[model samples]
Target chain A: MRPTPDPFTEALLARADDALVLGHRLSEWCGHAPTPEEDLALANLALDQIGLARALYAEVGAGSGRTEDELAYFRTDRDFRNCLLVEQPNGDFAHTIVRQFLYTAYADPFWRAAVGSADPALAAIAAKAELESAYHLRHASEWLIRLGDGTAESHARAQAALDALWPCTAELFEPEPKARLPDPVPLRAAWSATVDRVLARATLARPADGWAQTGGRRGRHTEAFGKMLAEMQSLARAHPGAVW
Target chain B: MSDDRRARAWAAAAAVVDPELPALTIADLGMLRDVTLAGDTIEVTITPSYTACPAMVVIGWEIEAALARAGLGPVRISTVLAPPWTSAWLSPEGRAKLAAAGIAPPPTAPADPGLFAVAAPACPRCASLATERISAFGATACKSLHRCLACREPFEAFKAHGDGSISNTASRDVLS
Candidate 1:
């Protein structure tokens, strides 16, 4: 029987799993992004996320003697602890931007605090990752304003994307009040203001918080995640060690 | 030992400043990478900062030409992927060279435990204040993002790659 994860291990593993899966999601755009700079940028961000994933996986798996590959590639979908927001479908450019905005906004503050954490390893990883994520936030923010405030088509499409993605942003801020990880209050509170700036710049309407959904933390996800996992893990499952 | 010959050869080779940052010589940025004397042929390994930087092919040709002018015929420039070139390879004198050219010198990043692995920075121009260090990675791979409080501009500092540890360098490549 498998043992339950320690709180610290769970937190680290959650971050690693989030990064690994999202990195794979971003990797899908390697050759498919609409522009060359965006293509390179996606790939670069994917690389950075994977790197961060490896560091966290290394730390979390330390108690269990698992390598980063073992945690990243060998795990089944049920074993993954990432928020559903990250695992959602990358429907369009706007979909991609909204996903990035939600995740990076929360991640920025998390990494900032993690850098000064009681755990030195997490702190070290957070230090470098913080710089990298800062750039990612800037990139995402620039696009937000551009799309939201651009031409009619851009403004309409960006507003529509924000409407679809607004629900997912809540998942990032969800945590049990007594949870041992960093405080959720500030992180939760920070998202609205952060998103507000981007939306305001983009001329998009703010996503109303009338009925925010929350199940990703409880191991429940939208339909999108299962499909994403199937595609991402197919090659790995088909050939266990098939590497070029 | 062809110390004198190597000096002149290196100096001649150094005349090729990095096309991106024109003020400093290729040697000053440590872009020359290595100067090996194999019988009569000199092999210099040059790695471009960005993967697709256009300057690489032209710089490779320039390296060969400079060597020919220095009387070292049959110079071959290989763009190496392994043992990748980092901006940290910029030398102290190189940063000073940049500042003396009127561009603000790169910041000397502190080797804080939370930031970089090392903490020694001498101005590429003035050779003063190892105390100032701005950021770890600079505008590109081969430079560090630094700001000399003394100079007061966000300058791109050349990373002086010394202590010749291939292992640490490899780790950095993997991190990137």
Candidate 2:
């Protein structure tokens, strides 16, 4: 017996929407990765993340009276609520790893909160996602350490990556209005502080000189987002009314 | 009767070897997940070993042909990724059949259930062999490459999705 679509439910649903947008951003890097093995690895991981996103959004879409495809592809840029870091391009191999490390560190705790959400559907999806996110964090963290400490040249590039990516990482911890959701996740409280701890171990310093980037949450997207949407939805847009 | 005839027809027609990993049939590998009969329509669910696996479209065509030949009105094939297919779903008999065919089976899950093994992959070529997994991303997402020192032959190892761990080891191309 699902409750009559409460505010907490909406928040969980919003969170899922946010994740789906970010997952779409990452999927663009599928075949372009530097190495074939890495290309497959990243693409495969992107599929898993997208798979997780689809589950979340489809469940939320069911609750919201919209189809998942409609929710994902039809929405205007301003309607998306994803984190800013994920929408950033895979600048280089190190840059991509930096983005994943920072994002999953935050998501690991976020999913843990969702796993125990009062809403059972949210909880079940979170439980499954928690395992996936845990692996993602492991993958990112290992890469973070490897890139951070690898060689002088690799270290310099990774540091530059850290500097470029750090600003957006800040937005991941900022609180959203959980008060309105049917089963609000206590995501921010538990997720933010620990990522700060993990960053220290990466031997990477938080950007001390840069201003933090924000706005994807409020649907204020960077210029890159519209391009992302254009390509991602191109097939559907081009093949309108076409069916199997 | 008719049901037996339909199943037999399907079983024969769909026993096509999966193009990506030829050791197993589309049916035995669980890629051909389900088949349902309606007088005017036949519906099938096919699972892809990997999400991006190229073999799916071919399998879909095969399913249509098999069902159409059996005189089922129309064939409908759908793909499901959820409860995403893992090697765990590989039937025990599928393993024995794989091994009997000389292809190494997937790594065994420990009975302990508590201590999840992360690094070990056994070599199928030599009985006393120590195996080294070369890469987490195999020929496809569903398989990994491993070599046994005892036999000096590199083999494909099925990846268990249940284990949420991925080892960042080296990558070796699987020749077979």
Candidate 3:
């Protein structure tokens, strides 16, 4: 019989899933970004996220002697614990930027706070990831300002994407039951302040909060998440135990 | 004989330069974390600067080759991710080497994305504070591109990591 995960392990698993899912999503744009430089930048971001996920998974599985691949590839969608925000469909360039901006806003402060985690491993990961995520936030913020204040069409699209994504932002602040993870309430305030400051500079309106979507923490993902996972895990599953 | 072999192995491994920087050796960069010897077998531990640094593969191979040249029977190069690497590890000589090669060393402070302006890196060429960041990323993963207004020359700055404070070398060099 399988043992129930303790609070720490569960929180770590959630962190890993969030990173792996979003990393895969970002990588889908590798050769497809509007500019060549952007392509490299997005890929770099994806690689950082994937690397973070690998480390988290390794730590989570160490006790069970399970490898990162086994946790990443063999797991079913039902087992994923990432928030719904990361798994939402990447709509357009504007949508992607908005999604990235909102997520990074949360991640930057979340990682900074995590640097003080009681768990040394988590603290170490946070120390490294905090730097990388800070860059991601800046990258996305610059794009937010550019798109929102650029052409009329760009401005309209940026606003539209913001409205579409605002609801998902709520999930980032929600915590798992009995989880020992750092409290995200302060993170939410920091994220909102950062987001508001950027939006003001970009001449964009802050969308009003609507009903916040939930359940991803409980592993209930959107329909798009399943397809994304299928593509991501296909190669690893096909070549079971393959090593370079 | 074993002591001779171990010393030779250390010398060889220390000589391998970082592939991306080329100007600095692994030892100079503080990347050669540790080397262990047990009879004829040796194990070397390396920590990569960035999570996605592609240079690690070449570095591992280079380490193997270096040890092999010393007539070491077999060697294992292990990459450790925890306790992650930091710019604070850059040696004083490594910092000089980077400056000489036209790459500004990271400031002692661990750079925060929110705090880029707090401790902007000086231009390695003219030692001018009048430098502006062109790109947060450069030709390599560990560097960011900056242009010096005084010299009208563009250069790369090694990113600062760990704690966001200037190291032994202060921003005073540029301000002066």
List the per-model TM-score of the A chain: 0.92, 0.86, 0.96
By lDDT, the better pick of 2 and 3 is 3
- Pitting candidate 1 against candidate 2, the one with the higher DockQ is 2
Report how far residue A71 has shifted in candidate 2, in Å. Answer: 3.4
What is the TM-score of each predicted model, taking all chains together?
0.62, 0.72, 0.84
Runs off by more than 4 Å, candidate 3 = A1-4, A177-180, B1-9, B36-43, B72-78, B81-83, B96-104, B107-134, B146-157, B164-176
Which candidate gets the maximum DockQ versus the true structure?
3
Candidate 1 residue A44 C-alpha distance from true site, Å: 0.6
| Worst ten in a row by lDDT for model 3 chain B | B167-176
DockQ for each model: 0.05, 0.13, 0.28
Candidate 1 ranges with C-alpha deviation above 4 Å: A176-180, A241-244, B1-176
DockQ result, candidate 2: 0.13
Give a tens-digit lDDT track for model 2, residues B1-176. Answer: 65875576567445767767677777677666666676645667777654446677887786677666666546677776543454666767677767666556765561211111244456665654576655555566566566777777777767655432212101110100
Q: Better model by lDDT, 1 or 3?
A: 3
- Give lDDT tens digits, candidate 3, residues B5-112: 777778888889999889999988888887778766888888878776778889999999987777775898888765667788888999999999999998876635
> Over 4 Å off in model 2, which ranges?
A1-21, A28-31, A116-128, A174-201, A206-212, B1-22, B25-86, B97-104, B110-118, B147-153, B163-176
lDDT rank order: 3, 1, 2
- Ten contiguous residues with the weakest lDDT in model 2 chain B: B167-176
For candidate 2, what is the recovered fraction of reference interface contacts? 0.08
What is the Cα-based lDDT of residue B117 in candidate 1?
Answer: 39
